[model samples]
Every structure is written in structure tokens, then in C-alpha cells.
Target: MRVAVTMSAEHEDARYPYDFLRHNYIVYLQNLGFVPVLVPNGIQNPEDYLTSLGVEGLVLTGGGDVDPARYGQENTASNEISPMRDETEFRLMQCAVDRHFPVLAICRGMQFMNVFFGGSLIQDIPTQVNAALDHRTGTHSIHVLDSRIEQALGIRVWDVNTYHHQGVHTTTVAPGLDIFATTEDNIVEGILHPAYPIIGVQWHPERPSPSPEIDLQLIRSFLDKAFWK
Candidate 1:
């Protein structure tokens, strides 16, 4: 299966710029026997082009902060913005929803998916929420909710790496979406559309880890969901 994976653009030089993806993403998908196609920054209607390329699913990879304005907020101690990439991803998600396309949104991709669906977010978790742990860089246990994801993985609790400054909570979630997993402090870690093949996680499954078997299983399950549903 061919999967469209989002990428981040690098400012290499003044004349020419380039878009690059993380190696782990390629390695993970290749190991699973899926072709990883890059959806670089600054593309209009990316889903249309991807569909033409026979892309079966999409992986919204992690990257810079999403513009708070996209979720009805002003500049609030966030990192740099990728307006073009945001637009491309938003459109791509819309197409995915329209076609019921399978999607795996990670980190910033998860946040963007929430905001795109009329949900709000905590711009900066450390500054905004009174949390004991540093979610920006650490590992934590997430309690899986009673949902399709839990049934697919058969895991009630799982430890995942964290590397984000923003997050969502249950009270701020969009209607009709299931909160799949949450940290001890109730910070949302994963979400899923109850009736669709779409899923999002606040961790990077492709990142190097001591044991990646479970992570690989998640990806495989997602692909199987896409293929069968």
C-alpha cells in the first residue's frame, strides 16, 4: 500500500529550499511493506494529488507548532508556524474525512486534527496547565479508554514518549470523537473517530525505542483497518 506522509521544509539556502522527512518514518513503513510517499510543504489540495498517485492512506507527521490562530487564539508563547504546511494538511484531512480515508496523525498532527474538527487546545501545556511532569520531553503511561483502539491493541495501559508543548483535554474535545488515551493528569494522548478508520496519537511511534514491537503492531493494525474498512 502507498501511504502519503507529511514532511517539514528546511531552509537550506536562500535560493533553493527543501522538504525532508524523518528517517524513522520511512524505515517503519518500509518494514511494514508500505511505500512511503512524501507530501512536502506548500502544496494545494494535496489529497487530490495523493489520490491520483494511488495513495491509500496518510500519515500526518510531527513538526513545528500549529498557528494558534487556526484554533481561535492569538500568539501565546508558541513556536514557529508553518502556514503553508498547515493549509496543506487541513485540506488533506478534509479530503480524508470526505472519503473515509485511513489516517494516522502524530504529535502536532493530532493537535491539528482536533482543532480542524472544531476542538480547542492548550497552546503551551507547561505554562497553561499546572502539571507535575514535563510533558515536553519524557515518557509517561497512558490509560487507554474503552474504544475501538483498545480493542484493536488489547492494551489497557501503555507507555509512550512525549515531545509536544500543546495538548487537548476531554472538556475541550470536539463532539462525536472518542478520547482513546490520556495521561495520569488527564491530558489527552490519543483520539479516534468511533465510526471511521482515522486515528491520532500524541506520540511518535516511528521514533527509536528499546522495544518497538507494540508500536509496529499499532501501525499494522491501522493499516489493516484501512485495508478492510
Candidate 2:
């Protein structure tokens, strides 16, 4: 299957900007039998570009934080906000929602999905939430609350690698989406749209995992959903 994946934009020498994707993302997708198509951040018409590529699915890769202004908030806690990437992904998401396209959003991509669906983020977990777990580093346990995710991975509780400060909470979850998994501190870890082939996780599945089998199974489940005529 062909999948459209978003790339992160970074400034080189403060003069030139370039796009990059983690090699793990490409290797993981290829191992799962997916033909990955890299999508640049500076595209003028991302929705049209997706259509042009004839991709069957979309993968929103992790990178810089989504600008808070997009969610009607000020630039309080966000870092390395990429306006071009945000604009492109939002357009791609609009096309995905309209077409009921399959999407796998990871880390920052997951937070972006929440904002795209009329949801809010905590911005900075440490300062905003009391007694929050150390989300910037190390691995944490997340309790699977939905049967779909549980059945897909064959485990209820799993320790996932964490590297994000922003998070989604139960109260801030979107209307059409359901919280599928969360950490012990009540931080939202997974979300899925019941009506669409869209799933967002606060952890990076492409990165090295303690349980590699579970990660593979998750990607397999997404690929199965992405299969269409």
C-alpha cells in the first residue's frame, strides 16, 4: 500500500530550511509492506498533492509542536512551531476527514490531530498538571481502555516509550473521538475516531520499543484498515 507521510522542517545555518523524516519511520513502514511517500511541508496544495500521489493512507510523523494559535490559544508553551508544516498537515487532515482516509498520527502528530478535531492540549504537562509523570524521557505504562486497541495488541497494559511534554486529557478529548489508552497519571495516550480510519497515539511506534511485536501488530492493524479497493 502507498502511504503519504509528513516530514519535519528544520532550519540549517539559519538561512536555509530543509525537510527530514526519521529513518526508522521509513524502515518500519517498508517492513510492513508500505510504499512510503514523503510529503514536504512547503507544498501549496497538500490535499491536491495527496490526491496526486494516489496514496491509500496517511502517516503524520512526530516533530515540532503544533502552534497554539491554531487552537485559539497564545504561544504559551509551544516550541519550534512550524507554520508551513501545520498548514500543510491541516489541509491533508481536512482531505482525510472528508474521504474517511486512514491515518496513523504519532507524538506531535497525535497532538495535531486532536487540535484538528476541535480538541485542546495541555501545552506543557509539567507546569500545567500537578504531579505529572516524566514524559520528556523514559518509558511509562499506559492502560488500554478500548477493546479495539486491546484486541489488536493482545495486551491491556503496556509500557510505551515517552518523549513528549504536551498531552491530551479526558476533558479535552474531541467529540467524535474516543480515548483508547492513557497513563497512570490520567494522561491521554491513545485516541481513535469510531467513524473514521484514524488513530492517534502519544508515543512513537516507529521508534525502538520494549515490545517490538506489539508495535508491529499495531502497524499491521493500521495496514489492514488501510486496505481498500
Candidate 3:
């Protein structure tokens, strides 16, 4: 199956901005029989562009934080805001919603999905949430609350590597989305839209883990959804 994967915009040099995506994402997808196409930010009419690509599914990769202004909040703790990437992804998401395309969102991608669906985020977990788990690094246990994900993954309780500062909570999740998994501290770790083929996880399944099969299983489940539906 062909999948459109979003890339992160970087401005290391003021005169030479560029877009990049982790190569592992491509390898992971290819290994699972997917033709991974990297979608650059700042495209003209992104929805039309995605339609032209003839992709069956969309993959929102992890990157910089979503702009707080998107959710009617002032920039308090969020960093690396990419307005162009945000615009592109939002348009792509609209197209996905319109076409009922399956999506697998990771980390920042997950947070973006929340904000796209009229949800909010906890700008910074450590400063905002008291006694929060060290979400910046290390592995943490997540309780899978949804049977669909549990059945797809074949395990309910599993440790996933963490790599983000921003997150979502129960009170801040989008209306139509369900909190499928969460950490012990109650920080929202996974979300899914019941009416759509959309699954968002706060962790990066593209990265290596102690049990690599878990990540493979997760990707397999996403591919199965994307291919069969």
C-alpha cells in the first residue's frame, strides 16, 4: 500500500530552510510492505496534492511541537513551532477526514491530531502536571484501554520509549476521540477516532525498543487497517 508520510521543517540556516524525516520511518514502513512517500511541508493546496499522490493511507511522523495558537492558547512552554508544517498537516488531515483515509500518528503527530479535532494539549508535562513521569526519555508502562488496539498489538500492558515534552490528558481529549491508552500518571498516551480509521499514539513506534516485535505488531496493525480498509 502507498502511504503519505509528513516531514518536519527545519530552519538551521535563515536563508536555507529544509524539510526532513527520519529514515527509520521509511525503512519500517517498507519492511511492512508499504510504499512510503515523504510529504514536504508548505505545499500548495496540500489536500489536492495528497489526492494526486494516490496514497491509500497517511502517516504523521513525530517532530517539533504544534503551535499553541492553534488551540486558542498563548505560547507558554511549547517550542520549535513550524507554521508551514502545521498548515500542511491540517490540510492533509482534512483530506483524510473527507476520504476516510486511515492514519497512524506518532508523538507530535498525535498532539496535532488532538488539536485538529478541537482538543487541547498540556503544553509542558513536567511544569504543568504535578509528579508527572519522565516523559522526555526512558521507557514507561502504558495501560491499553481499548480492545481494538490491545487485540491488534496482542498485549495490554507494555513499556514504550518516551520522547516528548508535550502531551494530552483525559479532560483535554477531543470529543469524538477515545483515550485508548494512558500512563500510570494518567497522561494520555494513545487516542483513536471511533468513526474514522485514525490512531494516534504519543510514543514513537518507528524507533527501536527492547521488544522489537511489539513495534512490528503495531505497524502491522496499522498496515492491516490501511490496506484492508
Count the clashes in each prediction.
0, 0, 0
Over the stretch 1-229, how does candidate 2's per-residue lDDT look in tens digits?
Answer: 7889999988523477888998999998898888999999878887788888888788999988888888889988888788889999998898888887789999998998999999988889999888899999989898989877777778898888999988898878878888989987789999888778888989987888876787678767865763221
Best first by lDDT, ranked: 3, 2, 1
Model number with the top lDDT: 3
Compared with the true structure, what per-residue lDDT tens digits does model 1 show for residues 11-104? 4333676777889889987888889988878876686788789988888888777888898899877675777778888888888888878889
Candidate 3 C-alpha error for residue 200, in Å: 0.6
Give the lDDT of residue 116 in candidate 1: 83
Show model 1 residue runs off by greater than 4 Å: 10-17, 226-229
Clashes, model 1: 0
- Local error of candidate 3 at residue 77 (angstroms): 0.5
Q: Residue 172 of candidate 3: its Cα lDDT?
A: 92
Identify the runs in model 3 with alpha carbons over 4 angstroms from their true place. 226-229
lDDT of 2 at 162: 92
RMSD of 1: 2.5
Task: Name the lDDT value of residue 76 in candidate 2.
Answer: 88
Instruction: Tell me the TM-score of model 1.
Output: 0.90
What would the TM-score be for candidate 3 when compared with the true structure?
A: 0.94
